[model samples]
Target: MNLIEKAASRINQGDALSADTAALRSQASPADEPPHAPLVQRAQARAAEVPVHAEAPSAESEQEIAERHVSRQITIDLERLRAAGMITPDDDKHQLAEEFRLVKRPLITNAVEATSSDRNRNLIMVTSSLPGEGKSFCSLNLAISIAMERDRRVMLVDADVARPSLLGYLGLQAERGLMDLLLDPNLQMSDVLLRTNIDKLSILPAGRGHKHATEFLASESMSNLLDEMANRYPDRIIIFDSPPLLVTSEARELAAHVGQVVMVVESGRTSQDAVKEALRQLEGCDIVNLLMNKGSSTPLDGYGYGYGYGYGYGYGRSGRS
Candidate 1:
């Protein structure tokens, strides 16, 4: 019998001998057999005795890894976003997480819970009042958050033609993206859709910048793309990360197609007027909700805004009293 067949037979019989014992019994010298021969025989025997199947990683584990790897680049803690509010028992995150059991989870949990039920899958508009407000970060995080849900599909469109960030965030370099789709209207949406290592999330980057970005975004072709996506992936949440609302009318113009605007306001930096003006510009659209980004850091004593966790500073009332 061949060595492999002998090993299999020995394994099936459950009478296999150890490598040393087998070597001593065999006429061939120790130098003759390959070093791993015994190991190979044992492995074959074990496989014959017990069959096994490989499974993919769990969703929770995947999310943990994604957060760990992605959050490393930024100083922001996912927990802080949840536990930064008030401990006065009125904080939204605390109340919601307590009720839903999602508080202990990542901040994305809160975002997913907030957007999960809508039938429309919410074509949400993401924009900041001014540049450097972390709008891109907010957009990407929100998309990742929504995509974490197993039941939901997420498509992120880089509507910020001026300065796209999704491709950079994902570490992919491709010559074609949203611009290619726009330039060639006949191209399939799936052609430009790039799958991410993160599950349930696909990205359509700004293919190429145009001199008239605003006009292209507002064109019927863009509107058709949105419609096709909505129809094709009804369960998918579509997020468009666009330019600052006040800086350019691009986000506002795109809002008409999306139907809802989620304004991301940077705390301590964006002026009240700019925010108000941006809100006014999006007055006609359906606003999913408003989020205060980078609102305030945790106070010195660890009591500050209730991030997703709980208001660290204002935990139990007895401690405060």
Candidate 2:
């Protein structure tokens, strides 16, 4: 076998060893085991009994790993979302949904119909000038809107390492996600990715926090992870809910890797200078679009909500409507 094949073999072996160790431990009775012996010793004893050249992974072992690595499924509270004026799968006719529909059309077009030169257009980042400007709200709505697409899948990543609110918004508890993937090479994307009851929608939490999160966001591993996320499935759109650009260095570092950015500007709240400086930090990106969120416009529907979209600000603007 070649080096790649050998590596795969070893990984498979390791997985099988892990499964066998668990089985042995579970099967061992309390009277059969010494209480003082470390768990590692028991695992080692089980490993020593196996042949040096073990058989290839069995069908059962593969099934076990598949079951173990399957994404944790979650159910979003549709009623809570509807009550909060957010978009839901069943209520596409709502005004908020209509607004997001307008907001997502150009974004969908950009991702679906991109030229060879367009680098990771499907990997979009959503951020704001400062916190509590409804970036998270916009991020969730945009993700749900895209997930409504017939031909697309959306993965919402909580890249706000400092303050993650996506899980709480969806009424989910803390779990391993993006940070764990960056910190541990053994943790596969399947292990942390959350598969929602919402069709074609997945979520990656911010995972555990690290002091050098800015450096982690800028690392080569992060680049590779982003590449995998962008290219693994051609129909997938990865939306990152990043931190406020002016508030955290991590967002600026993250902006460099994505092809397009949606900077949310709350009407009458975020200062012009803050927006300008935030956009300046994202200068490396090829496509930067502005989203006017939480406006006071009251349409005939009696809902005081509005949104505006700035098509494109960088090269290859012709593709966007």
Candidate 3:
């Protein structure tokens, strides 16, 4: 008999396949080899032992599993951040930290006093007119500053789908995140949301790229996701590191969902015309703030870092928007 016939005959006789059967199969001629059909039938028979409608895991249990998955903490290198002139929780006294403090105040206030009409005030996007203008840097520092709040938590999302840099700044490897969440309805926020060594701070990488990324950002799915992030926790703030307005349509689409926009301008390098064009793209947003980075202002404490803050018309040397 052929291998399939022998195996099926043994199974029908309520006998397990012996080592002899395995040896026989190994030595069998090509024509004597078992077809896959019987093996599939055997698998089906085994699977029939289990009920088709097994009880689903409870919501609480699923949440626990998600929490366990998100508990893997991403440790930010504080020394690296210090050397890069970024904010660290331990260095609240640094000039950059203080500058970010002024930058984050109005954002926090708007988030706290959000009316029903301003439902998404807590969702902020940091962008610039052109590349290399320090939007990512400002986004990182702003998120860190907000995370340092006593009662507030922050989720920093890298929305610059074209080129992701937040993870590089934090010294983290890219993994499944925002794009995955949008593409797969099966993915839970906890499956990709990363907790960090910094208390009250979490991160969502840009995830994989897609050709329709701008469409995805402008989709109803993204709006729903933003709503969930905004209302999930009363004390949480989400910061999006967006693409440059003049360079990509992604930022404008993303701006439609956020209540506030912080446009980072390189003081001397970014011309007034460039800032105006960038601001024009954000005219749909009610709260647009300007942050001037790498300005002509003298370095603070001789640390080679300077910051200046102003409202709609004023521009300073240090970073502010």
Question: Pairing residues by index, what is the TM-score of model 2?
Answer: 0.74
How do the residues 44-118 of candidate 3 rate in per-residue lDDT, one tens digit apiece? 465567576976432222233335344457788999888776789999977667767777887898789878877
Flag clash pairs in model 3: 289-321, 290-320, 290-321, 291-320, 291-321, 292-320, 295-317, 306-318, 307-318, 308-318
TM-score of each: 0.58, 0.74, 0.73
Colliding pairs, model 2: none
| Number of the candidate with higher lDDT, 1 or 2 | 2
Per-model root-mean-square deviation over C-alphas: 25.0, 17.9, 25.2
Count clashes in each candidate, considering only residues at least 3 apart in sequence or on different chains. Answer: 16, 0, 10
> Candidate order by TM-score, highest to lowest?
2, 3, 1
- Native-structure RMSD, model 3: 25.2
Q: For residues 1-321, what per-residue lDDT tens digits would candidate 2 score against the true structure?
A: 533233233333321001011111221110001122344455446656878799733222222234223567888998977766678999987666776776787788888888887878899999988987777888898999999988787899999988998998877898898999999987777778888888878899999999999999999999989987776667779999999998889999898898788887665466766766776676667776677655533334555343322222222233452
Candidate 1 lDDT, 1-321, residue by residue in tens: 633343233334322111111111121110001223444455446445653564543332222233223321212223433332211112334332232122112222322444433323256667777877666665665675566565666677888888887666444564456777777856655455565555666677788888887887789987776766655444567788888887887887787776445565554455656755666676555333344444322323576543322221101111110
Specify the highest-lDDT model's number.
2
Q: Where's the lowest-lDDT run of ten residues in candidate 1?
A: 312-321
Q: Which parts of model 1 have CA positions greater than 4 angstroms off?
A: 1-121, 297-321
